[model samples]
Target: MAHFPMNHPARPIYRVLSGLIGLYILMFGVWGVVLTAGESLFARESNWALGLRTNLAFSIASVIFGAFLIIGASRRTNLGHYMNLTAGIVFLVTSILMMSLLQTEANFLNFSMSTVIVSMIFGLVLLGTGLYDKVGPPELAEAERRSRDKQISEANTP
Candidate 1:
């Protein structure tokens, strides 16, 4: 089983990173909405917004997701942990799906190669952030840490 560090010392950094990503997404969405105001919801035509191809549908989705991420990052409880994990998976899956649909008529979000790359990067970061940002009681964290250390030592001995 995968062991996720709890009460990690670098939790603050991960939180900030997630927040920044959220801010960028929010800004990109707002700009996309402005640029694609009259365009079709799923327009296939190129409409660049904040360096990413977008449409009304994609812009709106970005706005909602960005807000969600911001809220998750602001929380001090495990809610943020779960949110980051979910967002990470969602991003990874979406990027793969969009990439596959990139050359097809089914590309509804008008995603570009750059967008896919960014999404993948964001997904990985979020996943890492989630893995280390778990919160718990002090004793539980200590116990988990000890277990992890023991596991590492055992592996090294083999």
Candidate 2:
């Protein structure tokens, strides 16, 4: 028997969430790109210890991931299916890590709040898209139906 996979369209919620997540990624990427390019203005005493190299590394990573995320989300590629969930988790984890990285009296406490809010936004998008995922379950259902048909046919055969 020939085998063919079924086509599945992403749910509306997933598309919306993916786009929003893409935009969020773009925002961070732009922020990083700007900071890296214009380091002199945003430079702080604390950042001195972090060094230029570290900042550049992080900025580049942000830009790549953000741009890819936007593309993946817009394209709705297979890889994007995983990236969405992973990005959401990553943002949440990073937000927590950032909170701990800061000293209690750190001047950038507001940054923490912003991170938390952004993290929550990603979390919500992930939750919504994941819950509304349209592709995965249908395939499982199709496979199950085929299995049931095979079992029935086997039982009927003498």
**TM, every model:** 0.94, 0.57
Off by over 4 Å in 2: 1-10, 35-59, 104-111, 134-158
Candidate that would win on TM-score: 1
- Per-residue CA lDDT of model 2 for 42-144, tens digit only, reads 2333221112212334555656766766765665444555666677777677667656764554423223445456666776676556444434456685885
* Whole-model lDDT per candidate: 0.93, 0.56
Error of 2 at 83 (Å): 1.1
Please list all clashing residue pairs in model 2, or write none if there are none: none
